[model samples]
Target: MSSRSYDIAVIGAGVIGAAIAAQLSRYAVRVVWFEAAHDVAEGASKANSAIACTGFDMAPGSLESDLILQTNPQWENICRALDVPLRRIGALSLAFDDGDSDSLRNLLNQAREAGIEAELIAGDALRREARTAAPSAIEALHVPREGIIDPIRLTVGLAKLAVLNGVELRCSTPVTGFRHHPSGAISHVVTPTGATAVGAVVNAAGVNADLITDAAVAEPFTMWPRKGQFLLLDRAVGHLVPKIMCTAPTPHTRGIYAVPTTNRTVLVGPTAVDGDDRGDKTTDGDTLDAVWARAERLLPEGVERRHVTKTFSGLRPASDRTYRIEVSAKVPNLVHAAGIRSTGVSAAPGVASYVADLIGAEVMELPVKSSVRESIPVIPRLAEIDTDVAATAFTARPGAAPDEHPIVVCACEHVTAAEIAAECRGPVPATSLDGVRKRTRATAGRCQGAYCSVGVSFILSAATGDQPGEVRHGEPGSHWETPVR
Candidate 1:
């Protein structure tokens, strides 16, 4: 097999890795990103409660707290340039009981200590802000900086931008092992395909980060998987809550959150269950029942379960109850970015810069590349286009770009067919149905792909030259095509 070399190799193409790759691409260095799966951000990055955290709830001085606060504004800038959907609608942590209300006050103090701008809104003002709140709720902590982001689009944008900046992204390329030279530099990374030499390596494999490091270099670190499950509500219930809503934090987990995504849909749940089982995508009946009960307690006008569109789960890598991000002293060329849980989406960009600094200090001698471009192509938004303006343009030229006219592919989310087609063929093209779903939200609607799966499969097959039967769903080996009775 032919060998390849790079100044740096980043394992795991999740949001953290993609962000790091994007940052590293700014310099004159050969950077290679490896993903065990067929697509990037297929792991925890895609699954979380897609909230842009404001660092208010985090442990005041933790690395996560610092990174999240730092990355929030950076994400705004990045998403603007990439056309990734982001809304600064703000957040409210409601308090039903006096205990919860006191907790909010404590969190406000913590937010202040963490340098987060937060205020305690009480009584009628809090009631008016979130009309759906439980009548028992006397107050809330209003975190004005908290927002919602499209997690998948954000990760894809970062990866695409990194590729455009000259980062080599190889999917379906899982690193199996590594060989270190006597000088303490990792000389080669062994993958299923073959070995590739690199000067330094980053471990950002999420739930499997520890496994990857143990197998690759026998690095000692433990990663416990914490599962978070979420339920997507139809757009019909989108008006129930305007801004992202949450409950006061408990000792074990941050209680369920209700967030209205950029696409007019409401999301709820994310019950933090114990253990490392990542396979539980099927929403637990008990969990859903509990979530509904909690929603009623938090929002008296509470959402209906009948309005639920889809349910999914994500596993967070937890280690020693803290985010592990540091260069391995035992393994000189290896950098570990493990134990990044729920806040990962918000902390990704800052984590990238931090990792880039580590790479600059320890790895290859490199300079800033003059040829590296500073910007990436932004995805067009239907919501941003004025209907009257579009009509005038279309009237002038009836058949302009076929893509200009929106053909609704996912009725629940209003995603267009043109958007799906573009996502399937654009930079860092999606290869599977899930990849397309992540990139374009084609099959992530209320029907949960029951209605649009077939059509999207046809579109994906037509784009990738794959047979409809071969077009899989959520992951590879999970085919979506079967004749309906």
Candidate 2:
């Protein structure tokens, strides 16, 4: 019904887009970030292995290697500013056979060229280093800079910081197309609501980038979906792997891996299933079985399906030319940051910095604002705090009314009514049951919303002023009544 204008417009609110938007906020400029999903990181950023590894084993001269190598070192400062959780536990690419050992040597050689510290550990040292690593693994390439992170927290934190820096985030605003000027520069962007006039445009649309580029008359940069099926084991299984354990990469795939997530859950995953649809997040039985079969080979104790709490999948924006981040040749003021595969989480900040520099040169150069806030407020999780402290803090809030029965909505995850209410009405409100689950952890426990879903739906209804039955489960066109099959 109404249209707005901006100095710049960024399409896609995944890690890449969020990082770009956040970085651009450092300067005094009008920027708008657009996301098609109900929430940020709803795609590959939410899934993936969630590992922030140095691009040690990447192709030495490739774009991905360059971006990751440059970006990996900045994570500490970035995470600190955003208040996101990060753990630098390191990783070991296990060599199961003599041939795999040869591959480890090659991977280490590449690491050396990339200036990353990757050591070859074998025999007694290898066995003692990873207690859970199988004895059959004769050697491993020890990558010291590899780390694990909470992907959801990282994406949300970046978006929040961007919002704080005066970057307007418009979630659920899908960019329909682009209009170009006579001189070949991007004139503005067309969204579902209305067109937004802009000086420049950045296409970080993940798998859907080709649609935007095609309309802009750029070279055909087609992207296909490369699905990675993964499993999340219970916290009890976290002790099974002391560090991020992985297998030597094959020619076609990155192989499978297991990690102890920062959240204290054992994450086993990433079967490199290629050529699936972007919307195909379906966890296939065959792929999952394959994933565990490979993952168990690297672990002392084999993993059983019984210990698995969640089975899910994420799609990477696979392309013939991966990590093709550059300014569009055909369309002026059009920057393209797409096809950042598995290492998106690690490479996001780097992408953002690069895109920001491009925008500063091409679009509008604005001075840094002195009043730009450094950090956004972080909410405390009740699950991590001491019970006594949480209880005392919960009741300490200044209020005249007192209730005899303090409502506890999610017993499995220990989520309470007050926490749900706060997030439902927070700066970036939860639009669906899954949105609330990601924000508050309600109905995301062992039972997987078996008991708390109805209550969460009721709370959503109250917060959004909708009828209880009208509460949706996830994204648009989805409802809570039907279970995921």
Candidate 3:
């Protein structure tokens, strides 16, 4: 096997790793990013709650809290730079009884103590703000800072920036083990494709982070998949729930809630179940039914079954104890950013900054680039364009080329041929059907690819120079073929 060398090796291409790579891009360093999956954000980063939290309910002195608190206020600027969509529609945690009301009060105090702007509302005011809330909800803790984001785009955006800034991205390359130097620090990252010598290693490998950590040193903790299932409602129901409607947290789990996505769909659920399988994304009717029932308690005006467009699941990297964000005790060159659970979306920026600093202070000292490309041009998403204005129709944003092709490929989401082609031919281009979907939302609309898959397949085929049959829906072997019913 051929060997290579780099200043740093990031072992996972999830949000955290991608963000770390992006942060590192600001400096002049040789960095290599690795992903076991076929693409970035294929793991938990793709299928998350998508809530950009304000750390309102987090423990005041914890690292998670501190990072989230620091990162929360910077989302507007970060999302803008990345061209990711963000909506600050706010969140409401409802109360059904006096006990629940008291919990809200305590949470309010916690929020204030953490410097998060929050308020407690009752009766008429709560009802006025949350029109779809259950009639039984007598009180609520309103956190206006809570919002939703396009998680997939956020991950891809970071990755794109990293690639543009010269970080080498290796998807479908899984790190099998590690090699050590004379001092017992890691010297190389072993992978199936090849082994690359490195100065430092970052184990940001999500649910499989524990396994990655164990490969480098003795396991400090174990990781299990904390499964969360969600039901996506039709975009037509988006107006009915404009705000994030949440329920009081239970000792074991944060109960079901309803959130509005940037795609204009209503998301309801996330039934938390701990398991051993890292690859289990299976969702069941019974668990989803229970989830819907719980969500109904928060949103009284029920979403019709017809509007339930899709049900999916994601696994959070749950650990036996607190989050591990320090250098490995034995493997001095390896850093652990594992055991991050549901709040990764909210805490990614902070984690990225902290890890970069740790690398600079502990692993290596690198000089900043004289010129840093801190932002990239936003891709012209046809859906976000003001097509209604005939005078300004088809005019691309600044730094983007004009859209000459007016042909709409995905009618459900207004995804145009140009948009699909652009994503398929970017710096970190889409190589599969799902990749295009994540970047352009082509197959994520009302029909959920039923109406647009063929069109997307053909466009993706044309863009990547792959045959129609060669264009897989996801990773290798996922061919563009219909199932035998």
Tell me, by lDDT, which candidate is best. 3
RMSD of 2: 2.8
Model 3, 107-189: lDDT tens per residue?
89899999999999887888888886566788899999898999999999999999999999999999999888889998888
The Cα local distance difference test for each model comes to: 0.79, 0.81, 0.86
Task: Give a tens-digit lDDT track for model 1, residues 307-352.
Answer: 8878777877777645788888777888888888878899998898
Q: Over the stretch 417-485, how does candidate 2's per-residue lDDT look in tens digits?
A: 766776677666787898888777788777899999888887788788877677878887787673546
Ranking according to TM-score, highest score first: 3, 1, 2
Total backbone collisions for each predicted model: 0, 0, 0
lDDT of 3 at 385: 71
TM-scores for all predictions: 0.94, 0.93, 0.96
Off by over 4 Å in 2: 1-3, 386-392, 395-408, 482-485
Runs of candidate 1 exceeding 4 Å displacement: 278-280, 300-302, 392-406, 482-485
Worst 10 residues of 3 by lDDT: 395-404
